[model samples]
Target: MRDLHSNRPLVWSLFAAFALVTLYMLGVRTLVPPDEGRYAEMAREMFVTGDWVTTRLNGIKYFEKPPLQTWMNALSFSLFGVGEWQARLWTGLCGIGGVFITAYAGSRVFGQRVGLYAGLVLGSCFYWVACSQIDSLDMGLSGMMTIVLCALLLGQREGASARENRNWMLLCWAAMALSVLSKGLIGLMLPGGILVSYTLLTLQWRLWTRLHLVKGLLLFLAVAAPWFILVGLRNPEQPAFFFIHEHWDRFFKTEHHREQVWYVFFVLTAVGMVPWLGMLAQSLWLGAKRAPGVDPRAFRPRLMALVWAVFIIAFFTKSNSKLPGYILPVFPALALLTAIYLDAGSRLARVISAALTALVGAALLATVPFMPGMAGRSTEVALYQGYQPWVLVAGFVSLVGGALALLYARQMKRDLFVLVLAVTGFATTQIMIAGFEPIGKARAGTAMLPAIEAQLAPGTPIYAVGVYEQSMTFYLRRTVTLVAYTDEFSFGLQQQPELAIPTVPQFVERWMADAAAGRRNLAFMREDIYTALQAQGVPLRVVARDARRMVVANDVKQK
Candidate 1:
């Protein structure tokens, strides 16, 4: 056990293996819709259009999010040809980088063992690992917020030199700026709120003096302001929509239709922690308590982490709109606190955590047979059936790993217990995420890409009739005209009215005119819409189809 903990080469090899797996997993799963496909398509448009100043999705102005993620993904596409992995490259790197940063911060503030465990905890966390592989704004935002967090901890910890404090605090501020760029105002607001809560709770008023406020604020603006300025200059409508509608309206009102019960985040926290659930409550409780012999006014990273997790969770819970990913930034803090607790906690707690993992695994194993029953459509039955084997493997691996970890804990093999649990958690998450490929493949509409591509020319008019498959835009390398559909694209459609046919009749009229002109017209629409159009005597020839959607052409003859 001692040798395992102290062996530098083995430790580094584990880190390298974990990193390689994380990067490899980026390409393993197809980009799933609303978030993953939305961002990928946005970046593809940016790369193709060469419009770095303004961000657009589906050839319409999209100001709901700041463009840091888009910019990064677009840059990824530029460097490497556009692909699923390329779209997700930034979020993956951010996730890996966050693990290293947290480890370094934990080593500095807590101890070497705590640092090692902290990295393992975060790197293997089900939620963190899962989000890392999925290309979404939350992971990107969380990654930058992780920097904002660790940098502050490094800067404010006791016994820091003046130069070290200054440099770290500067990094903290700049990261906050990047955080804002990744999401929106919550980037600055959440961290600032957490800091205030920490100060009020711990009475760490003197901590502010070391923040280098003047220099830090300047550095922040320098990194975060130019994009806002250039983008706002180019599109005057962005400022109002982004700052007011995106932030205030989304938070204060239920306009996005994402509201949920108050206990949702709490539930997510419990589930997201997975094998570590046994240690979570105790860790948070202990985190709020000051260590014995520590100075009353000294900087406390544990308390800071507690406040960071609590404040962000509470802040979002108060918002009328909520999502599973909103509380992602809290994972690093939780991992740190959990690591500290495991390093110094009771043997009973360790055993219980390991046992809980085994129980969860067993539970998952029992549910494998019921997976096919959960599918709504008959066609989805095969996908769910294909996924069952993967879940069975994951469950067995977790069950074995957890039992081994429990045995290690009972035998006082502390290092082995942690390593086994970490690897189990990571492997289980990767397995489940990769196992989702069959379902994701259907959702992404990638299977129809070859058929769809064969029907396209340089300027073939493609209409997204009553629906949009977010991934198709990127795969087809072209934008579709919105027909009688405007969910998230409402604002963008408002800006470019000419980009859409707002009503079914209008779309049908346009299709008739295009057919008369002998122009190739392709469309993607729901099965019901296809039926309705067929009933209306529209000249629609099915090019390709899945259970949920269909692709059709205006006429039989190719233009």
Candidate 2:
């Protein structure tokens, strides 16, 4: 209440610094397995195949999730030329945009100081920064949800001009639609659920009349429904698999192999906050003690934000589906709440922030030796050992930075204290990502592409037996024939049965046919599968070998 507005220059300067790290530096890294590689290759395939309506992974109908992210990435590839950076541009932009959106809305709801600090909290949060540059759907979803959260905050202000209210609510509705496109109905449903809980807590049903439900619903359907309808028309099974199976089943059942203990989300939030975690907890404690808004009877934006954060954590706690990134929607609200508390210059918060910063430094330093444990295989441990030096450097820098932040906190230099931790955390995270190349090397099929390319003869059928690598098709620039292997693409293969060989015997017969014709063929398989094929007299010569997989070809005369 006492001149807590941000100094524009300071806010802009810090924000600019954060952008430089998130955009250019983070963009330079390799895409990791499963998610990053999968999504990047999807966009790549989208660009190459020019079949945007029916999403395909390795040329199979991939209807597991919606395609807004892929569409954006595909467009990015068109303009920038496909590379790791171009592939990740959407998520980076979203993270950068999320900061500005939170700042703008936080200032409107609380004060400029809260706005600036909230941006810092989110910008420095590991989850926000890490996911932002990774080319994941969650970053896009979190970005859109941040907008919706901001719009809800501004639109729900105790007193606002009718036009302002209408515009804000419309933006909120439109964001929900965008979220649906970004991920699924949870985009709309998550926000809607939070709103219902907020209304119940605040006893503020009056805001509903002003929500323009009819117009908003029409707008949402107009923006989000067309894709659903069109995709369903084009692929009949998609409607059931997507709406019922993907959304609900993925959440309620352990179909994705992602089930974890209910407390897993709590762990994510704790680690996700990192240097800011202590400050956030202290802020939340203080914020909860009083009405978190302009008036006692008026709605508490902080409580709403707190409720927003808690609802998300509690919402998925019991659900069988879980991932570290799913809890990200709550960060913006928590950032706002933390910012408001910090703006009051809570002395204990500064002390705790200082102590926590030191603890983070110690933890990071301790993490150096454990780096090898992150590697999947014994051979990869040496590669992970090579990464240890970078981790050590980041740890040392963070230890020093944490000490400095502790000093700044003691001096009550709020800005510098926050800035120090933010920069250190950002650097440490970037270091870890940069050092992950060795691991990515083992996981990505990228290097194998070149070796496989050198051996290819024209019309030489390439088969992936007992494995489906999502990134292989993108890197190879063509889909490999799936021989008895369809993991995530099982549903897609069901719709287009010709795309797969369902059994080992079937693949053996096909390979023999190709071999007898004196036509060379390529195959990639897990080591065990390759061994089994060899035992079955399928006749394969090793072309390339990695710790987890091998590339081979039919025993044939070299050209």
Candidate 3:
């Protein structure tokens, strides 16, 4: 019940420990496909190729995303060799930085206590924490979007000096630029839409007058325009594919096959905001209403946050393409609202939230025994079994933390109660994600790295026939020839047809020619494809293989 600000040492120590564990967990698990492996490989190729402007995946020109994440990842690789942690350094920093910025903005807009609570809420949310350690664009984009949100809140709050206003607004502009580079037009589109929604709902038309639109537009264009210009100039086909196909077509068409029912993100948000689920509905409802005696024309930070969250969720919900990560930008807004609500909420509300946490923990414990059943492949049974103990530990941690939270809430120690729940949420998510290493290992095929390395020769042909493990190309420090395999790479292959063989017959002809010339060749294919090739008397000697993939080499003698 003491002033939390007075306990500075405890607060700093808790944050320090959380940060250390998060950094340690960066390298704790293998990079899983298709996002983790795909992004990492793209960065690796950029770093190795020294072609920063043009992003490539497995040596094919890939224009699906802007190169901000790839540029950052490649910079990480240049500084510290290519590895799991290096590949993830940008996203990890973004995640951690998002927490600090949101907390600082909360303090300025609300209060110190509210800021502290906001940071805790965001840092522990399951979706935010899990994405932070993964090598993907979602965390990078979310982190930048967090900057745009926080900077706007700080810049637009009441009683700000002109100098303070301009600086924060500029920072918001720059972050939006980076956000555009991180994912695409959504960076600017999302913020622009949120601001419009907030103005219409709150009638804060004067907000546009103070946004420094002229200066902000200049800064945004400066940061975001060069890459689009240069990449488009160099690759003429990039502009249409990236702008129309990647953004417009992706949003309106279900060709990406990511379509889901309208309520999918509603389900994701409910599950993603664990331990705070009981507080979500109330916080959002409270966020829409202005507090007593606030100026009608003055900025409503809470309402802005509410509008920000709702607009983003609704934007993606209307899209024909829906992925869970698409809705990640809303978490910071949700965190701010939840933090404000909890700081002033009743003890009964706190008790109910804590009770829900404990109940969820118990449910997790009950499901621990059924993990093996979740595996679709026989090879995955042991991997899921290996994950059980971790689930057990996480469940117990959540259960005990929730019990302690209940005790603290009853004693009117709100700070301790929230801290316990935050730590519990963060710890449980980290443990479960780290526990996925066994399954990640199978998908990564990193165990085959050693055998594949031993067979490498300068300029030797390596083909990916019927399948391509994105991570394998990065781990092997080389690109693979694509043979009848172009899923996401279809556009890239169309841009550079010479980069791929185009069909199985072409690959087979090349393989036979290489054998006749006594040259070496290697291929990676699905087990079934390998079996079918063997039935056709293809000359392949198994070099290394696992349950799902096979690495085979030509049986011809090397000259």
The digit string of per-residue lDDT tens for model 3 on 398-503 reads 8888888989989989988988889989998998898889889898888898888888888888999999988888888889999998999999998899999988
Per-residue lDDT of model 1, residues 1-559, tens digit only? 6656467898899989999999998998788887899999999999988999899999999988999999999999999989999999999999999999998999899988999999999998889999999889999999999999999999999999999999999999999999999998898999889989989998879998999999999999999999999998988999999999999999999989999999899999888888788899899999989999999989989999999999988998999999999999999999999999989998888899899989878988999999999888998999999999999999998999999999999988888889999999999999999999989989888898889888888989999988988888877888899998999999988889998889999989989998888887999988888898889888898999997788999976655
Q: Predictions ranked by lDDT, top down?
A: 1, 3, 2
Model 3 clashing residue pairs (backbone): none
Per-residue lDDT of 221 in model 2: 91
Clashes of each: 0, 0, 0
Q: Estimate each model's TM-score.
A: 0.98, 0.96, 0.98
Off by over 4 Å in 1: 3-5, 557-559
Deviation in angstroms for 230 in model 2?
Answer: 1.0
Model 2 lDDT tens row, 1-559: 1232445676577788788878886466667778887898889989988988888787788888788999999999999898888889999999999989998888888876778778877887778878887889999999999999999889878777788888998999999999999999889888888889878877878768878799889989999999889988988888988888888888788878998987999999988887677777776675566553456667677777888888889988977888888998888888888788777757677777767767776876798788889877788889889888887887777788778888887887777877777787778777777877767766885667777889987677888888877666666767788887777877887888998888878888888887888778888888888777678777788888878778888864555
User: Which 10-residue span in candidate 3 carries the lowest summed lDDT?
Assistant: 1-10
* lDDT (Cα atoms) of all candidates against the true structure: 0.91, 0.82, 0.90
Give the per-residue Cα lDDT of candidate 2 at 422: 75
Could you list the CA RMSD of all candidates, in the order they appear?
1.1, 2.1, 1.3
